[model samples]
Target chain A: MIEIEHVSKNFGKKIVLKDVNATVRAGEIFAIIGPSGSGKSTLLRMINLLETPDGGHITLDGTDIRAGPGLTLDIRRKMAMVFQKPAAFDENVYDNIAIGLRMRHVPETEIKKKISDVLEVIGLSGYEKQRAKTLSGGEMQRVALARAMATDPAVLLMDEPTANLDPVATGAIEELVLRINREFGQTVVISTHDMLQGQRLAHRIGVLMNGIFSQVGTPREVFALPKNKDVARFVGIENIFSGRIARISGGVAEIESDGTVINAVTPLPAGTSVCACIKPEDITLHLVDGSQTSARNVLDGRVARMTAFGSVTRLVVECGIPFSVLITWKSAEEMGIAEGKPVKISFKASAVHVVEDTEVRRP
Target chain B: MGYIIDGLREAFHLIVSLDPDVMEITALSLVVSLTATCVATAIALPVGTAVKFTDFPGKKVLINLIQTLYSLPTVIVGLLVFLLITRHGSLGFTGLLFTPQAMILAQTILILPIMTGLTISALSGVDETIRDTIVSLGATRLQFLTSIVREARFAIFAAVAVGFGRAISEVGAAILVGGNIAHRTRVLTTAISLNTSQWEIGTSIALGILLLAIALVVNTGVSLFQQR
Candidate 1:
């Protein structure tokens, strides 16, 4: 387990990370998800001691890694990092993969055995004699991964490893990451700006923004219930409305926004100012008014704009304020959905996640 | 034109026959300049690596200063060494003036700046990501430095070749420091100078061809090393 406590870092005057805290559990894939320049890479570098934190401490397996040079090396050797840019030393594949093992003074025979095993794992067997610099980008990245895996580090940290790869290459690297984690159970921490990747691979995801983890939870929790507007938007939550609770009865609360009342399940008291967040996928659209459904909240609106993205169509519905809704292309074709078409949108009260309004808005 | 053709023919004959006098001067030139190049590389690589890795005040300025000295005049180096080893100078006790050792010393000094400056460039040419990978792979400080140096081996070899080319082709330093003493301190460049002054065009042409041939061999060797 790696514990990052209140870590802070700055480059000259620009604060890269600020009072960040997160814990990576053993044998679980923890992913840092954020937009570009959100400090995900900086956080990963700090965990590996590549970039020292200006404040706070990072501990590996309950030992403070920054205590001294001796301890830092010991801690660092237990971890391996693959950077976004694939880099290989100017050497043959076998020697490149053997570098870490040789640094530890592993016997030559054992190093050879490890190299063969790792090459097989990365699907580059029989490439031992090939110069690493001569490989294609994807092949070189695999070699880098193989090089790191040869050491069998307890923690494998990857910072946007597939960021520069094409889609097919990205899939291959993702598969390798999953296989390594499942087969070896090495604690893995990967940072990516691809939210879907974080959702696909990580056991837990940390939503990083403004140099701090705004929310850290299971992928489902973070995707469904982001902590704030920034995270909500980052996680692809498009329907967020500023409102105040008009009344609370039983377990449901009625929130008023833009002259419309929205029913959601929240324990916040009446008159509490909040923002109601909803995922675009959760809201269903019907052409007819009052279509039979068990959903609690229904709003009548007109499609203000329509944009097609591959198989799905995104509709901007202006009920009182704009609410973004996603529907399948076939459904849209069947209903003849178009701009200025009147539509009814319905969603469950539980689907409306409520967070207390923390951001001050200007009039 | 007839005399020039005769000189070329005589030069060809002298090389093909491997005349004892020309061969001795060629061999001494090789020994002195090669030794100077070896000595300069040994000292320059470490100094250059140190400058590349460490952060200190005036580091950029120091690098600029070293680069500016890349064109340092050989005669200026000769004069400087001459004063240092003159009877009343600081290094006079060693009696190195007007000797082969003094020539070697002068050539070493003459090439040190270019070698050191190019060594630094060779090291800097290594990608920063490679350094990160080395450290992340658990390399100790020594191992990291060694790995980086190995990565830059080809460029460093080229730097050494350039230093040798400069050292072997220089005339003023050898003439001033060694006094061009025939069959003793005399080397290729000094011998070429003396032969030209005395109108011994054939001997000068032969020595000039030999110097170019040495440079060609050194460059070819460096290219072959790079290929490997």
Candidate 2:
């Protein structure tokens, strides 16, 4: 297990990490998600003692890594880090993977066997003799992964490892990382700005904003029920309606604003101002003349704007309140929805998340 | 123009004939420069890498000193070594006043600064990510430095080449310390000077062309290595 206690790092007067405490249990993939400059990379470096946090302690397997200069070397062998870029040595791919093993003075025979195993694991068995610099971006990252894992580190720390690769490479790396986690039982801690990747790979996600971790939980909990407005917006909350609580119906809270009543599943305190949020994909589009749907919230308006995004179309319906709706291209074609066309948008009250408003919750 | 044509003809003839005097001088030049460069590299690489990778007290001063000496005059270095190795000088006990070893010692002084300066530039040119990745892989300090040197191999190669070129081309230091002996210590640069003094244009021009070829080879080899 890796434990960080009250770690704070600073460069000159600018504080990069401020009094952070976190833990990574063995054999779990814990991901840190945040915007740019949120100190996630710096935090990852501290774990390997690369950046050396100006204050606080980082311990790997109950040993303080920053005890002194030589203290980091022995403990760091148990933890290996891969950067956003592969940073492969200008050697052949086989040597690149065998470096950590060679450093540990492993015998030549075992080194060859271990390197071959890692190369096959990362799907680069035939690339052993190729120059590392000649490999593609994705291939280089795979080599970096192989090199780190060749040591059989107890903890593998990655900072945006897939941020530089294409979607196909990203998928491969994600799968390989998952396999490493499952097969080798290596604890993985990765930081990324890609929310989809974070949701897909991470068992638990830590949300960091402005040098502080705002929330740490399962992806479903963090995405569906964010702790605050910042987390909600960062997670791509597209619909935010400013409204005042009007009344509470059974399993529904009605929020009135600008001559429209919005129904939310979660109750809010009465007479309190609140913002209602819903994802664009969550708002369903229906024809103006279609049968009345079972969704709790529906708004009737003309199609204020329509934008096609390859496979899906985004529609902005301007009723008493503006609503953003996502529909498939085939559905949009069937409905004949276009700019200036009339349409009705509907979604369940549960899809409308009452956020940061006491009025939207029950007293 | 007539003298120049005659000189070129005689220079080519001397080169083809494998003149004993000219060959001895060329061989001495190669040996002395190679020795000096090897010694300077032995000291400069670790020192330069340490300077580049770590911050310590008086680092700026040391860097400044190296930069200053990088442009040091060959004659001034000869004068210093002359003063040190002459009788009554500090290291005079070994009687190295007029020997190839003394010449190598002088040239080593001249080349050490260039080697150190170029080494600093080479190691510093290495991408920071290379060092960070090696460190993250749990390499010890010595292993880290070794990896960095390997990553900056081309630059370090250039540094060595420059040092060799500087040492081989130097005339003042070798002439002063080695005394430019007939066959033992007479290098190509000193032979050129002696031939010019004696009006032996054929031998001097031949050795001069040979020296230019060596320098050209060194420069081109370094450039090609860096390109690769």
What local lDDT score does residue B73 receive in model 2, on the 0 to 100 scale?
93
Please, what is the whole-model Cα lDDT of each candidate in the order they appear? Answer: 0.92, 0.87
The candidate scoring highest on TM-score is: 1
Model 2 chain A is weakest, by summed lDDT over 10 consecutive residues, at A354-363
Pairs in steric clash, model 2: A267-A360, A267-A361, A268-A359, A268-A360, A268-A361, A269-A359, A269-A361
* Model 1 DockQ (Cα-based): 0.68
What lDDT score goes with residue A131 in model 2?
88
For model 1, how does the per-residue alpha-carbon lDDT over B1-228 read when each residue is reduced to its tens digit? 987888899999999999999999999999999999999999999999999999999999999999999999999999999999989989999999988899999999999999999999999999887888888888898998899999998899999999999999999988988999988999999999999999999999999999999999998999998887
**Residue A89 deviation, candidate 2, in Å?**
0.9
Fnat values, candidates in order: 0.62, 0.81
Q: Candidate 2 - CAPRI tier?
A: medium
Taking the tens digit of each residue's C-alpha lDDT, what string does model 2 give over A1-363? Answer: 878888888888988788787888888999999998889999998888878788888888888887777766888888888899867788899999888888889999999999889999999998888989889889999999999999988889999999999999999999999999988888999999987789999988989876677778899988998876677878877677778778886767898877889899765576768788888988888788898899988888889888886588888889878887889988888888789988888888888888655334545
Model 2 quality (TM-score):
0.92
Clashes of 1: 0
RMSD per candidate (Å) reads: 2.4, 3.0
Model 1 — TM-score against the truth?
0.93
